[model samples]
Target chain A: MKKLLNDPADLVAESLRGVERAHPELRVDHEHRIVYRADAPVSGKVGLLSGGGSGHEPAHAGFVGPGMLDAVCAGEVFTSPVPDQMAEATKNIDGGAGVLHLVWNYTGDVMNFDMAAELAGAETDTEVAAVVINDDVAVEDSLFTAGRRGTGAAVPVEKITGAAAEQGRSLSELADLARRVNDNTRSMGMALTSCTVPAKGTPTFDLPEDEIEIGIGIHGEPGRRRVPLAPAREIAEMLMEPLLADLDFTGGDGVLVFVNSMGATPMLELHLMYAEIAAILDNAGVVPVRSLVGPYVTSLDMAGCSVTLTRFDDELLRLWDAPVAALGLRWGM
Target chain B: MKKLLNDPADLVAESLRGVERAHPELRVDHEHRIVYRADAPVSGKVGLLSGGGSGHEPAHAGFVGPGMLDAVCAGEVFTSPVPDQMAEATKNIDGGAGVLHLVWNYTGDVMNFDMAAELAGAETDTEVAAVVINDDVAVEDSLFTAGRRGTGAAVPVEKITGAAAEQGRSLSELADLARRVNDNTRSMGMALTSCTVPAKGTPTFDLPEDEIEIGIGIHGEPGRRRVPLAPAREIAEMLMEPLLADLDFTGGDGVLVFVNSMGATPMLELHLMYAEIAAILDNAGVVPVRSLVGPYVTSLDMAGCSVTLTRFDDELLRLWDAPVAALGLRWGM
Candidate 1:
């Protein structure tokens, strides 16, 4: 593969070195592979943390800064981080208020974060609370997940919970808020092309040029089905049908529609997809109260897009609009 | 080609619809195919307008907001916008303080924008100034450019000049500052693969799997040469050697190092490349006071990256640090 890397084994660490150099506002723990906000462990403020495999960048590490994640444990590519990394990050970012782990509902990630919480409780006097997010309606189980795999909702979940944490909320309150955000959010993804892992110099999966994988997982896991390639309008219907059926996003304070590029897809296509989705929503009488369109959470060099809809109330909207300085998602600051 | 689009003919207009729907803060004139800041003609603020082909997204249109471009004209994919759109945008955004046209140095773009300036000058009372950016050090003359092809430096030029305009600089002053920023900046791009323009439905150029194009232009124009695929460190050397040779980025107030993805390159690779570039700069005793690493300026789904270094003075640094709320680049607000 023609990737800009020296050694596949050294990819994550070397990339983290660049992240450390590029963002002075963040502190990187090279040994443990943890990225922490420089001013982490805010006095008496709830500490927020989230992480998964490293390929879905700007998710955990890029979200570390003021008004977002306090720390993140990055794993190797699509592999889960060890419990030791998470436990160390939890201990370090724990303020007097406590620490909250926002775990995406991948089987390995959930298990590891659980073990990390247990380790933190046994070692330090930190109160660790965990919230598991399972918002992907693509499948009930995948190759790497036993339940519905968490996909795009991690963004809004982290943003809203981090805002609540920045407001000095308790660990339990942040946990509840995160769970609420996840419950209200639904995401579905499709892939036109598969991404290649650095370790495996070939694409993670094979996708013919004339076909696509609908409801595909972020890590090239098996999706609902493979379908013939179609226009964005049809693709939007394929993604939105299950999402609307799974969640009641028609009423309340409207929905926060997030149209994200899955790495290789350009903004032109993402915006075109957004217009198709927005047209569908408009016809369905679903008002989009807030919208985010870009590549926030992405697979590595995967050509596709995902749609996440969060039914937001005033509180969630307020928190989303709050000033944030994270590299992945920054606004109002 | 796999892309999320309906019809290639309707791509630009449809995507602009998505942009208008997604960002309520920006207003889009569908008839003129121009994106404008919602509060255009900001009393006495000098207007900043930039545009070119549609494929290089988040360039001109995405930069329309506070502390950035006041208006942007959109052309078809990889095609220069006509003079009518630019003239209409100029007439609308003029706040009685005149307007500045930020033109990328492409043959069609330079010619069309020149005609637009004349049209605006003769038809309206608005004074107009122009700054043509030609920061690419790839070649003295290329397929579509006379001197140099504008590449990654459009971001900083628009940013610094936009900030100056926000600070109430006159039209002539903004034009001078833009030109100064352009003169101090140098950029070089290398592509691992070729991009597919939506209309063509084929790769812009042929790139074998084992080789890469160094010193590639943003629009898939012929680069310096095709070379065997190398590691990120060696690739960084290839990109940096020419940039440093062309511009003396040492001394003064240091340099602003920008590592940008040419669309398909992920943050993981971009950050890794940034580390490699940083090490080279460190060895060269070139201090980087500010840095931007991401896909700010991009080609459509081309797997590659470009590096830009601008020698910044205290004034330029201050303006660079100013708050910007554009969709493409947002921080310090």
Candidate 2:
């Protein structure tokens, strides 16, 4: 694979330099591998911090801004940021109010953020709250692996919960909101091709050109089943079937839909899938109140899309309507 | 290419449906292919709108939010959004305060945004100001291509301009600010691997595992030259030498450095590259005011990195310090 990188070893550090350089208001604590808004210690506001593997752009770091995450700890590609990085980030961004840790379902992210919170609570007066988003419906509740991968649900969870924090909600309130959003949201993704990590320089999996992997995880994990490329309607059914079975989108006022690209899927196709998914929902008597189609969250250039449904109530909608400023997911100034 | 999409035609619509479902605060006009903040036409504010190809997640569209874009027009992957989309986005977001069209240097983006502005002007009292960001220092000024490709410059442009817009700066002033940022900024990228567009599920360009392409454009376009993968320091020199020559970073009070990942590059390597880039700028007598490293604007999951520098004035710094809330770029509150 021909690439445009200086060196595999230098890729991560160089990218961080670029981020810090572009947004001077956002400080890159290179020593700690954490990113924070330059205006640190945003007095009297509960600081929200998150971190995860580096490949997911705009997930943890891109989300650092007002009304969103206060800091983002970045690890190597596909690896969670270390505890030290998270600890420093939490400390740097923590205001007198408190701190909330929102992370995805990945084991690395969960464990690392937990460690950082522990370290943070021991050292500072900052109270801490943590929420893990496990919204993927692809993985059933099983004992073998962590059940359900967190996919598109993380985007809205962060956006809405971040807004709650910005509104000066109590730490418990923010944590509750995060937990509720996580509980209501369910996501399932499919992959057409495996993406190559820069260091690996090869496809992550051997997917035949004519086949597709259903229920693929964000980290290039194998899906529940590999199937031939099907029509949009059928594929939507395949994705939605599991999600519908997992949750009752029918007994609610409506559900929010997120058609997320797995990095490489274009908006043209994403919208097409959206049309079909909407039809499927309509057929199933599921009213759609809100929708998000795009690569809000992604796997590196993987040719796939994930469907996330979050059944929302009035409070969730109000929180969702709150203004947020981040690198992705923003509205209501 | 085994893509997980149901049908190639359904891709975009499905994705947009997901976007709409996921983000309740953003209004998605699937037919028009425009995404707008639900509270657009902000009563009295310059409507800031920008967009382009789809694969660059968190760009153009991901940037729509408070303190940033009022709306975003998403095009097909690697292709500029159509003029109609931009026109609709402009009209939908226009609040009788006029509009500012911030576009990148791609021929398609420039032409389409211009057409949209013209169309928008014909129907409404929406005075439109256009500014094109041509910050990539990869290509020397040439007649053959649209100046230097706007690489990492879009982030700062959107950010500073968004701040100006939030401050209630008029359309013309926002345009001027964008132009000033463009003038002061320069970027150069190197790719370690060619990225595969989702529709075309193969490497855009074949590259041996050890080879890298320097002076690359954002959209998987052929770069100025291909070279063997080198040490981070040497690669930093290779990218920065051309950028420094194009613009004198020396004696500048301080410089903002952006080490952006195209995608697929890890954060670990980005920091190392940042250190190397800092050394290069230091040798050139460029004091670093700030640094950013991440995959802000990306080309699918392309494995590459770009370095961008902006010589900042106090005004620029203040604007940079102003609060911004968007899905893609956010900073001071």
DockQ, in order, for the candidates? 0.83, 0.26
Per-residue error at B42 for model 1, in Å?
1.2
In candidate 1, what are the lDDT values of residues A99-170, reduced to their tens digit? 999999899999999999999999998899999899999999889999899888999999999888988988
- Taken over the whole model, the C-alpha lDDT of each candidate is 0.92, 0.77
Q: What is the TM-score of each predicted model, taking all chains together?
A: 0.99, 0.74
List TM-score (chain A only) for every prediction. Answer: 0.99, 0.95
Docking class of 2: acceptable
Residue A59, candidate 2: alpha-carbon lDDT: 65
Clashes per candidate, residues 3 or more apart or on different chains:
1, 89
Judge the docking of candidate 1 as incorrect, acceptable, medium or high. Answer: high
